[model samples]
Target chain A: MPKVTFPRMGESYRAFRMLMNDLGNEVIIPPRPNKKTLDFGVRYSPEFACLPLKILTGTYVETCMSGAELIITSGGSGPCRAGLYGQLHKKILNSIGFPVDIIVFEAPKSHPIDFLRKVKRVNSSRLSYLAIWECVKRGWEKLKYLDDLEKTTHALRPRELKKGSTTKVYREVLEWIDGAYAMKEIHEAGKEALNTLKLVPHDTRRAVLRVGIVGEIYVLLEPASNLEIEETLGNLGVEVHRSMFLTGWTRDNTVKETSGILSVKEAAMPYIPLCIGGHGRESVGHTILYARDGFDGVIQMAPFTCIPEIVARTILTRVSREHNIPVLTFFLDEQTGKAGMSTRLEAFVDLIRRKKNAPVSDNRIIVG
Target chain B: MKAYMGIDVGSVSTNIAVLSHAGEILADLYIRTRGRPLEAILAGLTEIAGLLPAEVEICGCGSTGSGRYLAGVMIGADVIKNEITAHAVAASIYVPDVQTVLEIGGQDSKIIIMRNGIVTDFAMNTVCAAGTGSFLDQQASRLNIPIADFGELALSSSAPVRIAGRCTVFAESDMIHKQQMGHKLTDIINGLCEALVRNYLNNVGKGKEILSPVVFQGGVAANAGIKAAFERALGLPIIIPRHFGVMGAIGAAQLAREEVEKTGQTLFKGFKIAGLPYRTGSFECGGCPNNCEIAEIYEEDRVIGRWGARCQRWDVL
Candidate 1:
C-alpha cells in the first residue's frame, strides 16, 4: 500500500484519514500547522500566494519529508487564486527536492472520470466503485458529525460556568469521534458528546455578544489560518455563529441545492448579484443574513490578496451600512501580528457591546 | 482625596494620568517610551505621583494601549482596555455627542465612528503605518526640522504642493522631488500634512461614516497642520480636546473608577509599585514548533507572571 498524506484543514483531516485507511492506503497525517510550518511555507512559496496555499505547501513539505509517498489536495476552477494552489504547491514542492506524487481532487461535476481515476490511484485495495462510494459516504458522515460538534461548542463556550471547560469537552469528544470507525459507534459518540456538552453548567440568562463570522472557507475553518479567532471570540464571551462549514460546503458543491434553507446565491443576489468565485458571494450573503437576524456584529476574514474576498470586502461596506450592522474585515497573512489582531477583536467587541446596551428612541435596550 | 490612575504605555510614549473620584484630571505626565516601556512607565509614575497632593490616594488603576497587558500587570489594574475603546470613551466624556474620533498615534492611526455616544464602527491602520506619527517624525528629521516645529512650518505655508501619500517611501520621495523643484519648505511641509490626512481618510477611515462633532485625539493631535488638513478634507470643524494627548489614559482611569465602584474594591498595588525593582525576561518555549517567546515578569528574582505563549502550557501567572 502506498503511503499517502493530506494537508490538515480544521477537523477535515480526520475524515480524509478515515477515507484513505478504508481505501487500504497507509495514511500519514501532517503536523498541525504552527509557526515553524508557516515559516517554511513563507520561505519556500511565492510571497503573493494566499495564506491557505502557503500553509498547505508547508504541510505537504513536512509530510513528504516524513516519508510520505503521495500527497492529495483539493482542486478548483475559478477566478479565485485557490484554483491554482494545488499546482503551485506541487511545483514548489518538486523544486524544493520533495518530488512527491501529487493528486488533485477536482469537483466530480467538472471531471467525473478524472476524479474517479484519481481516487482509484490511492484505492490500493482495488475496491469496487460501490465500495469506494461507501467509504466516501462514511467520510462525509464524519464531517457532518465534526461540524455538529463544532457548532455546539461555539454556542456553549460563551455560557459555560467554568472557563475553558467547553474546550476540554470539545477536545475529548473530537478524539472519540476520530477514533470511531463504525457508523453506529460514531453516532453514539456524537450523541454522548452532545449530552455531555449540554451538561456543561451554562447560564442561559447571561448576556453574550452574538457575532457572525463570514469569510473564505479555509481561513474561517482553520484556526491556525485565522489565529484562533473563534476561540478568542468565545473566550471574550461572544457566541460565534459561523456562516460556513465543511459539510455544508461539500453538500452545496456536490449535490442538489437544498431548498427552503437560506441559499447563498439568493441572499447575495441583492448585493453581489454574481458568483465571484471562492466564498466571496457567500461572505456577502451571510453578512446580510446575520445582520437581518440581528447579530451584534460580523467579522469578515480572508487571506491576503484573495480576489474573491476582496470583492466581498467592498460589498460588505454597503451591506453593513444598509443593514445598520458593524463589519470588521481582516486580511490574514504571514505578516499578521498577534497583538494587533487581539487589540482589534477587543475593540470590536467593546463597540458591539456598547451598541447593544445603548438606549434607543423608546428607551429600550437593543440586545443582539 | 480618592483618585484613579490610568497608564497608557504605547510604542512611542508612556502617558500616566491621575483623575479625582469626580473625573477631574489632577495630574498627567507624558514621557517618551524611547524603546524602554517599563523605564518610561516608572519615570512617568514617579513624576505624576510627585505632582499629586499628598492627601490624594489612588483608589483604582487601569491600563491601555499596545503595552496595556504589561502595564496592567505591573500596576495591578482594575481595568485593561484596547486603545480604540479608551480613546472613544475619553472623546465621548469630553464631547458627549462626539460622532467620530480620529486618533493618530506613534505607530498606528485609528478612526472611530460613534452613534448616540456608543462606538458603532472603528478601524485601525492595517499592516502599514504610512501616515502615522512615526512617519511624520522621520520626515521631520529628514528635513532637519524638529518635530515640534514641523506643524508650525505647515501652518505658515502659502501654497501647499501635492504629494503622494500612498506609502511612506513614496511620500518621502515625492517630498524630495517637490523640494528639489524649488518648492518652499513650508509649502512642502503643508503638502506632506495634507497627504498624510488624505492617506488616513482613504485607508483607516475607509467606508466609515464620518459625521459632525468629530474629535481628533492622540499624540499627533498636537499638530495643528494635521488638524487643519482634517478640517479642510471633511469640511467639518475638528475638536481637539484639552487633554487630547492623554485622552487614552484618562479613559482608562475613568474605566478603572467604574470597575472599582462596581466591584467595591480596587486591585491597585499603590504608587509604591513604581519603586519596585521589576525585572522582565523572555525565552523561546521549546514545548512546540511555534517557539512562542514567553515573556516573564519578575519581582526580586521571583517570577510574578508569564505571558505571550500561544498555548496554555507557559501561561502561569
Candidate 2:
C-alpha cells in the first residue's frame, strides 16, 4: 500500500488516520504543529496566503519528510481562497523538490469519476464495497464521539472544581479514543469518556460567563493557529460554546444542507443572503444564533486577509449593535503574540461580565 | 487618609496615580520609560510616594498598560487589568456619562463605546501603530520641534495642507514632500494632525459608533491639535479629563479600590518595594518543540514569578 498523509486539523486527524488505515493505506499521521512548523510554513509559503494554507504547507512539508508518498486534503469551490490552496501547495512542494501527488477530495457531484479514481488510489488493496462502507461508518462514529467529548469538555472546563482537571481528563479521553481500533472498542471508549467526564468534580451552581466562538473553521479547530483561545477563555472561568464541530460540519455540508435541516445558510439569509464561502456565512449565522441564545458575547476569529471572514466581521459589527451583544474580532497571523491576544480576551471577558451585571442600580464598581 | 495606588507601565511612559476612597486623584507622577519599564516604574513609585501626604496609606494597588503583568507581579497588584478596561473605567467615572472613549497611547490606540457606565464594545489598533502618539513624537523630533510645541504650532496654522493618512511610511514621505514644497511649518503640522485623525478614525475607530460625550484621554490627549482635528471630524466637543495623561493609572486605582473593598484585603506589597532590588529575564525552555521563551521575575536572586510558557511547566506564580 502507498504511504498517504493529510494535514492535522485538531483531533479530527486521528479519525482520518483510522479511515485511511482501514482503507488499506499506510497513513502517516503528521506531527502536531508547533513553532517550528509555523516557522517552516512562513518561510516557504507566499507571504500573503492566509494562516491555514501556510500551516497546511508546513504540514505537507513535514509529512513528505516522514516518507509519505501522497497527500490528501479536502478542496472547496467558493469565494474563499482555500479552494485553490491544494494546487498552490502542490506547486510549492514540487518546486521545493518534494515531488508528491496531491489528491483533493472535491465535491463528488462536480467530478464523480475523478473523485472515484483518487479514492481507488488510496484503497490500493481493492477493498470491497461492504468493507469500504464499514470503514466509513466506523470513521464517522469515531468523529462523532470525539466531537461529543470536546463539547462536554468545553461545558465542563469553566465549572471544574480543580482548575485544569477537566482538561486532563479530556486529554486522557482523547488518547483512549485514538487508541481504540475496533468498533466495539470505540463504543466502549466513548461511554468510558463520558463517564470519566461525569466524574470530574464540578459546581452546577457557579455562575460562569458564556462566550460563543465563531469564525473560519480551520482557525476555530486548530489550537496552534488560534493560540488555544478556547482553553484560554475556559481557564478565565468562561463557558465556551463554539459554532462548528467536525460531525456537525460533515453533516451540514453532506446531509443537513440538502435535507433542509439545521441550515446556517438559511439562518444567515436575513443578514448575508448568499454564501461568500469558507464558513463566513456560517460565522454570521452563528453569531445571530448565539445572540438569540443569550450568550454574553461573541468572538469572531479569522486569519488575516481571509476575505470571507473579513466580510463576516464587517457585518458582525452591525449584528453586535442590533443584538445588543459585544463582538470582538481577532485577525490571527504569525505576528499575533500570546500576550496581546490574552490582554484583549481578558478585557473582553471583563466587558461582558460588567455588561451582564450592569442592571444593578448602585455600586457600579466591579472588577475581577 | 487611605488611598489606592495604580501604575500604568506603557511603552513610552510609566504613570502612577493615587486615588482616595472617593475616587479623587490625590497624587500622580508621569515618568518616561525609555525602553526600561522596571526602572521607570520604580522611579514613578518613589516620586508618587513622595508627592502624597506622609500619613496617607496605600490601601490597594492595580496595574495596567502593555507591561501590566510585570508591574502587577512586582507590586503585588490587587487587580491587574488591560488598558482598554482601565481607560473606559477612568473615562466613565470622570465624565459620568461618557458614551465614547478615544485613547491614543505610545504604541497603540483604542476606541471604546460605553452605555450606562458599562463598556459595550471596544477595539484596539491591530498590527499597526501608524496613527498613535509615537509616530507623532517621531515626526516632531524630525521636524526639530519639541513634542510639547508640536500641537501649539499646529494650532497656529492659517492654511493647513492635506496629507495622505493611510500608512506611516506614506505619511512620512508625504510630509517630506510637503515640507520640500515650502509649505509653512504650522500648516504642515496641522495637516499632519488632520491626517492622523483621519487614519485613526478609519483604522482603529472603524465601524464604531462615536456618540456624543466622548472623552479623549491618554498620553496623546495632551495634543490640542489632535483634539481640534477630532472635534472637526466628529463635530462634537472632546472632553479631556483633568488627569488625561494618567487616566489609565487612575482607572487602575479605581479598579483596585473596587476589588480591595469587595475582598476586604489588598495584595499590595507596599510602597517600600520601590527600594527593593528587582530583576527580570527570559530564557527559552527546550522542553518541547515549541521552545517557548519563559519570562522570569526575580527579587534578590530568587524567582518570584515565571510565565510565557505555553505549557504551565514554569508558570510558578
Candidate 3:
C-alpha cells in the first residue's frame, strides 16, 4: 500500500505503481496529465516548458492531495534537460503550495556526506540501515535486469520480425520483473523472454547498421522529442542501440562529482581529463562508449536550447572520426519536422551502411 | 624558419591560421561553421594547404574552442586548451592588461575575468542564447533590420526601450509590445542590445569581479551596437582587438609558437594531416567490474587517441 510518485515516462503512474512498490503505506496517486498540470508547471517551472516537467509538477500536486508528508527524489545534471530538473522541481513545488518535505537522494555534491544526509531522511528511526540496504539491493537488481534486458533487446533488434517487437517483449518482461518474487524467477523469465523473441525468425544476413542514440534521456527516450529517430532508423533497417541506461544514469553521479573533467569512477588513469562540465560530460563519455561498443554510427540527440549537448557534440564528432564511427545529430524543437527528421535518419543510416568504406562523418547538421 | 599551424573549430565557425616565429599570419582562413565544424575545418585547411611552402620548417600545431579536442585530433594539434586560456593568451598579447574579456560567439558566450594579466575567474553561457550573437541575429531578422545596420541603428536611438531580456520568448513578446506602443524601431532594437548585455551581466557574468581595461572579442565584437551597450552598462570604455572573431585561432597559433620555443620540438604531423586516412572504434573494458565504456581513435590502424575510458588505464595501452 505504499504511495509512490515518479516523473512520468510512458504511461500512467496509477497502473505502474503496482509494479514500483511492494506492500507498504497507502499510495497517493497523482492526477492525470492535463492543461492544469501544464499550467502549474509553467507557473512554477523556470519557463523551460519541457513535457517531463509537467508530469513532475503533477506528481507533487497529487502527493500533496494524498497528504504524503515525505517525498523521494533524485538529482541529475546534463548535456540535457534533466540536469536542472531537481532544482526546478523544488522551486515549482514550493511555489504551488506543496510544502511536503522532499529528500533528494542523488546529491553527491559532497560525496558520501550528501548521500548520508539523504539516507537519514529515509525514516532513520529503527530499521534505517536495513531499509536503506534493501532499497539499494532492489534498485541495483532492477537496474541490472533493466540494462541486461535492454542490451539483449539491442542485440536482437535486427532479428525481431515485428515493429518494436523486441521492445514490446522487453516491456512485457520488465513489467513481469517488477512483480517477480525471486532472483531465480527473474533470471528464468529474462531467458524465456529472450528465447521466445529470438525465435521470431528474422533474416540475420540483412546487415543493418547499428545506430547509437545518445543525448538527454528525455529526447532519447521520448519518440516525439527525438522525432522518432529510433523508429525512423529501425524502419530504415538500421538497428538502434540507445546508450542511456539506468546503469549509466547511476554511473553519472561519479561523473558529476568530478564535474565531468575527472573520471572519479576510474582512479588509476594518467590521461589529462577533459571535463565537458555538467551532464554534457556524461553525454560525451556515453557517446564514446557507444562508439567503443561497436556501433557503426552515433547520433547526438538534443533539444533546441540545450547547452551541454552542444559542447559535447563537438567532441563526439572528433571521437566518431577518430574511431571511424559515423555520427548524425538530431536537434529537436517545437518546429522540428518529422519528415525532415526521418529523411535525415534514413539518409544517415544509408550512408553508414553504404559507405562503411568512405570516412567517418561526411555529413553534419545544426537545427537552428 | 619554424612554422606552426592552429585551428579553432567552433559550432559556428572554423578558423585556421599558420604563424611564423615572428608572429605573422602566414596563412589564415575563416569559414562559417555552418553547423559542420569538421567539414569547415577540412575545407579551410585544403584552401590554405596550397598557399604554404612545400617544405616548410616543422613546428607544432594547437587547437582550442568549442571544437578544440576534435579539431586537435583531426589536425593532429600538439596542444589543446580552453577558450578562456587560449583567448586570454591572444588578448594579453594584444591588450597586455585586459582585466576583463567578454566574448560573444554564435551559440556560446563567455566572460573571462583576469587579474594582473592572469585569468582568475571565468563564466560562460553555452546554454543561454539570449546573451550570444544568435540572439542579436534573431532580433535583427524579426525587426527587419539588416544585420549590418543593426549596430548603426542602435547608435541613433533617442531612448532605448526595455526588453524582457531573461528569455528570447519574453524578449520577442516585449519587442512586439514596444513596437505597438509607438516606439521608434531603432529605439526598440537598441533596447535589445541593452537587454542582452544586461541579461549577460546578470546571468553568466553574475557575482564575478569585473575590472577595467576590459576587452570584448569573438564574432559579436564586430557589432558596434553591442560594444556601445556594454560600455553603457559598465560605465567604462572597452577595447575591441583588431582581429576579434578569430582570436581563438590566433591564440592557438600563439600557443603553438610558445610551446615550440619552450619544448624546442613540435608534434605537428604536417600539411599532409588533411590527406591522412583515420579510423576509430569503441569497446567496453571488462578489466574491472566497472565495465567502463571506452573509445579509441586511430590513424589508419594505429591508435591516436582514447576517450570515454573512465580510467586512463585503457589509454595507457
Candidate 4:
C-alpha cells in the first residue's frame, strides 16, 4: 500500500497532508522531514548522508515501526546521490535493525521488475486502488497546471507594473494550490488568477532569456533553501526550468537499467548524457542544451557541500565559453542568504540581457 | 576498420572511449554528471560518433561503473562489470602487472588492490567526498588558484607543511589557520595535498594491502600534489597512466572489446540516442514504515531502475 509522507518539507508538508486526507491514504503518511529524521538516517546511513537520504531512510524506518508490512517509494541509480539512494536506504535500514519491507517503483524508463515486486508486496485487498491512482493523476494534473502557469505568467511578469507582484501572487497561489481539492477547481482558480495577474499589465514584447536550475532536490525546489531563485528569474523576465521534477526523474530511471544491456551508445549515458556526470549531470546537460537551444543564459544551482553540482559548475565555465553562452552558478544551503543570491542573479541576468538583447529586471528587493 | 566502444558511468562522471582493435584510443569524452548517467553516456557516444568515421565497425560494446546496469540497458551493452573489475581489466590491459588501482572522482573515491592480476580486496567511500577530486577543486578555488595549475603549485613547495586530512572542512579550516600563521602559498598548498593523502589513506585505504606497480586514475589524477603525497606516504613510486581521467571510459571500452570478441557481434544501440525525450522526478516511498524518498527517471513514460532502497528485498519482490 502507498504510505503518505511529509518528508522534510515545511512548505509543502501541510499540502501533502491535505492531499493524503483527500486521497484517504492519510493513515500511512509519514511524518514531516526534520533533523531527527535526518539523524535516524545519518546514524544508520553512510557518513555523507544528504538531506533527502536521511528523510527517506527515516520515513521508511517509521513506516516499518508502524507495523506496515510493505511501503511504497520511487528510486533511481545514476550520477546524483539520489539515484543510488534506494540501495543505500535499504542497506542502511537493514543495518540499523529494521525488518522494513522496501517497495520502490523503478524509473519510468528502466526495468519494471523492481516496481513489479513492490506491487506484489502490497496486499491488493488493503489498497485503495482508486484513491492511489486518482492521487497520482491529480498530482500530474497539478504539475501540468503549475508548469503552464509558470510558462504563461513568466512571459510577462518580468515587465509587470509592480515588478515583483507576479512573484508575490505566485507565492500566494502555491500556498493555496497546496489546499486545492479538485482538478476542476484548480483550473478555475488558475484561470481567475491569470486574469487578475494580467490586470497588472506586463509588457508582452520584452525579450526573455532562459535559466536552468539544477542540483540537490531540496535546495532546488524549496525557495527558502535557494532564495526563491526561480521567482527572481521570473522577476527578471527569465523563464526558469528546474530539473529533477517527479516526472523526468522517473523517466530517466526507467530507461537507465534495461538500457545497459541494450547498447554502448546510450550506455555511456546512464542518466543524462552531455551533461554533468557524477553529481550535476542534469545541470551540465541542461546548461549545454540551454545553450544549444539558443537560450541566452543558464544558472546552475546546488547546495554548498554538493560535490557533483560543484564539479558541473566548474566545467560549465568551459562549456559556457565553448558554446558562447553566459552561465552563472549558485550554491545554496542552510546558511545561504537572499541578498547574496539576488546580487549574483542580478548581475548574471544583466549580462545575459546585454549579450542576447533579452530584457530583464535591474532592480529587485532581496527575497529572504 | 574495427573498433570497441566502452561506456563508464559512475557516481561522478560519464566517459566514453573508442579504441581501435590494436588498443589505441581514437576518441574519448568525459563529462561531469549532475545526477543522471544515461544522458551523459549517450552524449559521449554521440560525440564520438560525430568525430569518427561511420565505416568504423563497432565490434563490441561494454558498460561499467556505478550506472552499468542502466548503461547496459540503454546501449545494449554486452559486458557489465563493477568499477573495480572494470578498472582492473583496463589497467591490466594497459599494464598487466598493475598491482593497485587508485581512483578518486567527484562524489566518491576508492582503492582497488590487485595481486597476480586479480582483485584482492577493495575499499570504496561512496558516501564521503573528503579526499576526492572535487575536494581538491574546492580548496584550489578557495585559494583563487587555477585548478589546472593546482598540481604544479604543490610541486613547487620547498618545505611542505602538514594539515589535517580527515575531512574537507577541517582541512580547509586548518589551511586557513596556517595561512593566518603566515605559511607560504606553496607550503599551504602542499599541506592540502598531504591532507588529501592522509584522508585517503586513513579512510579508504585503511589497513588495506597496498602493493605497487600502481595506477592512479579518475579526476583527481590530474593533481600532482595528491600523486606526490601518495608516493611519499606509501613509499612507492606510483604511476598514473595517460588516460587517467577517462579510465572508466577506457575500462568500459575494454569490456566492450571483450564482449564483442566473445559474442561475435555488438550490442551498441547506435549513436543517435539524442532524440529520446528523457525526464526524471522524485517522490517519498510509502513502502513499509521506511518512506524512502524515491527518484524515478522516465523515457517516454517508462520506469527503468529504482535505487536508494535500504532493502534489497525489493529486488525479489
Across B1-317, the per-residue lDDT of candidate 1 in tens digits comes to: 99998999999999988999787899998899999887888788889889999999889999999989888888889999999989988898889999999999999899998878778889999867887999999998888898998888899999869999999989999999999999999999999999999999988998888999999999899999999999999999999999998999999999999899899999988888889898899988888665777888886677767877765676554
For model 1, the local distance difference test gives 0.87
lDDT of 3: 0.66
Q: DockQ for each candidate? A: 0.69, 0.61, 0.02, 0.01
Ranking by TM-score: 1, 2, 3, 4
Q: How are the candidates ranked when ordered by lDDT, highest leading?
A: 2, 1, 3, 4
Chain A only, candidate 1, TM-score: 0.95
How would you encode candidate 3's per-residue C-alpha lDDT over A190-271 as one tens digit per residue?
A: 5665566566556777777877777766666544345446655665677778766555555555435333324321321222
What TM-score would you give candidate 2 relative to the actual structure?
Answer: 0.95
By lDDT, the best candidate is 2
Give the Cα error of residue B217 in candidate 4, in Å: 1.5
Best by DockQ: 1
lDDT of 1 by residue, A1-368 (tens): 88999878888888889999999999989888887788798889887788998888888878888888888888765677788787777788888898688888888776889878897798999999999988888888888888998999899989999878888778778888888888888788778877887788889899999999999888988887887889889989999999888887766656555552256678899887877888888898888888888899999999988899989988888888888888999999985357889999999998889888876635445899
Worst lDDT 10-window in candidate 4 chain B: B308-317
Shift of residue A338 alpha carbon in model 1, Å: 2.4
Error of 3 at A294 (Å): 46
- TM-score for the A-chain in each candidate structure: 0.95, 0.94, 0.74, 0.68
Highest TM-score among the candidates is held by which one? 1
| Of candidates 4 and 1, the better by TM-score | 1
